[model samples]
Target: MTILNNKESMRVTLKSVTVPSIPLAALLVIACSGLWFSSYWGARLALFPNQTTEIVNHLQKIIVPNTLLSEIISFFLTLLNAFLLAQINNKFTIIRTRTFLPILVFMTLMGTWNETHLANGSHISLTLFILSLFSFFSMSRNRNSSEQAFMGSFLISISSILINPLIFLIPVCWIGFGMFQSLSLKTFLASLMGGLTPWILYLALNFIINPHFNVLQALILNPNFVLDISTYSLPDLVYFALMSIIIIMGIVGLYSTAHSDAIDTRNKLNFLVFLLISLCVICFIFINQFVSFLPIIALVYALLFSHPLTLKQNNFHSILFIVFCVINLVYAVSKYILT
Candidate 1:
């Protein structure tokens, strides 16, 4: 593909993506735009493939290794998860279910890179990814869901970390997601530790089996780690800032919805999720070396768990989200193209 000038590229983008759902499609559009956006940064970051810059080559690298269509599928799945969850909350009158969808968001990061720059393989073989969704639905057959759902989620998260140990931190997401429920210290701790335990077991197994994999050091730190440009963008920073506001609005909305009585389970859980995400984000800010993926985790949850709004309300915020996404992509592109 030729490096058309910026105006030409933008025109081509509009031509390729003209649609009736321009407003709604913006969200998905921005995602493809993001991949296009990453083309620039992929060249600049140029750490992976570890060689000279190549913009078109970088764009071609859209699909991560070992997960050919993971990005596209994950994005679509994220949409399905969000909508189904909102419907679940409305129907069951129970928001504490800890449905498998939130966990799916975290586990999908397995398709992402790691600190050692290894692909961090999953527990199940490649075929099991689809089965994960099946298991989630299958648990409904017997109606024994809470423990089973979480247990399935636990196994999946564990498998995810094995694929890439850094993913352990993703449960920081579960910790957040759990907040909109009971808020018991015991249950919350279980969620937190459950997310981490896989990596611990991974370390233990490696220590006992390999005896010299430097499992602890690798898990603790990665001296040679280079930032995954696929993960971040300066423009997205604005969206993150908006995400903070969305969280704030979510809190206010929940509070208003709660009417400040004795504080319901939903409110408690919401508080927990918000606090946990905040903690995760703060920790990453100080220690980016440890969890470069925190923003992705935080942003996903923020997008997932925001207060339920009407069609217009959702459309409104979705617009804000897309605008921020667009800015981030443009900045990412500039970083790529200018450098």
Candidate 2:
């Protein structure tokens, strides 16, 4: 009771600390340091090949010193993704306080020493994916802006797939989200045209590159699906489990509070977007591309999961929050030391 009575006590929670940039700056230090722990430093782009290898290869040629270049590009792209998610929070009031929890949660996930930082196709794809979400959410308020939002999201999603074909299913999710957001027939047709436009350009490029190139094989059946999580160590598994639980809790908390009149149309629409992305990530988690997909989930996790911490004062919630932070910190430190 005394702790709650204190004015500073509220500021001690995870939700509060994320509101300021200082904590996120410290998190960046810890995250970037952990990135150096592995054999990844100065590692060539596409450490291994995938659907996007050709594009990454072209970048490697133009960029010079593929490893550092990829890292720098991916890192800043990640920052932009984080900032965009924060703006979504601001636009939709996803979190009660305008906090940079999206970035903090992303950095926390990155701290797990996952291969999310390899400056690969996934990063580029996720960068575009975040931009797509930004465009999609802008459709919340203005019907007049829906066409731009629809076209922008479609173009971004198409470009993302050109790099990482595993996310080819995402445009369907986007369309579903658009319909959920009260999309008009005209916007729906516009989305179709927007998604199709990328393939037209891709085929044109392919035609110029190699006349013998098989357009069908190039476009279809390009994604490789690998379902294996056994490579994760015990600590990785533990952290994964805890984070998954937190996400489920966050979604449930948001749903429970959805009926409140205080929440508006835009917030509800944004929540639908969160739910859509979460489902898509779960469906594709078995693939190698899943690592890049984690940050998107992290953004949703921070938005939905922070609700309980902000609303509840119980000991269990407090303990859970502490454990979430500690688990990440310890896993990151141990991974850095052991590796």
Candidate 3:
């Protein structure tokens, strides 16, 4: 009869490979590198500009497509965003542990898809939104955070100029402030002022540069309320479904472990959950229009996924993580190799 010993069991169990270890870090690096190469290869072979690229080109009066330079810029921007994500978690302890899992997960997700390889308005908007989050998360439990509120709203407004759909995030920020217990009449007014500042400046600049700039034409607020799944292949749909399942698991892990966290941490996690739901709703309502926002969605998804994959050390979660990695690999192969 064959029997398994403790050492052999430990070798098979993922709990033995904790987050802050060298093996996990090396594995993350290898996986991200492979995924990045696949995406880069795909983008190099074909550069397709979606609707968001056209809108951005029209608004800016400059054609910026997915070129080598744009791809490089997008890659660097993603790295910067990953660093900022890690910083947010470290500074706020949002994940309740000091782990680089967020960065790893974020970079891996960014590398998984070809659409994210191009430097577009969405990348710029996501960068600004993350910068704003630094201020928003910092305002926790501080009623006198009007300055932070203004800065946060200001950055978000600037991002909205790049991606009009993101303007909805202004109200989301207000709701987040309320959740953070930092909302006040003063902060509310400041946030409004901050949100309007970009538009005011944009209008003024357009007036000086060209009086017939047609602000209404530039600020197109069209929303096609359609569940546009026609663009996605069966494999793509399956990959998204798997990702959704992981996100659901992360949400469950978050709530199941909520009582162990501090009040501030709980509030922040709740805000993240709310923000993720809001993004999903926006994506669903305007999938065709907001396709560029996938990178932003990936950012939030990575953070949420990191919660469970980092904290929950069980056979189920471990197997889930392994499955997640394998799915990504298979999807990449199907996307870049098979097709």
Ten consecutive residues with minimal summed lDDT in candidate 1? 116-125
What C-alpha RMSD separates each model from the true structure?
A: 11.3, 4.5, 3.5
Off by over 4 Å in 1: 1-153, 156-201, 213-265, 268-276, 294-326, 329-333
Give the Cα-based TM-score of candidate 1 against the true structure.
Answer: 0.46
TM per candidate:
0.46, 0.76, 0.89
Best by lDDT: 3
Clashes of each: 11, 0, 0
Lowest summed lDDT window (length 10), candidate 3:
10-19
Q: Taking the tens digit of each residue's C-alpha lDDT, what string does model 3 give over 95-164?
A: 8877776787688777777666653677778899999999898888888888999999999999887777
Taken over the whole model, the C-alpha lDDT of each candidate is: 0.39, 0.57, 0.76
lDDT of 1 by residue, 136-168 (tens): 333322332344344434555554443333344
**Candidate 3 — which residues are off by over 4 angstroms?**
1-27, 42-55, 58-64
Scored by lDDT, model 3 comes in at: 0.76
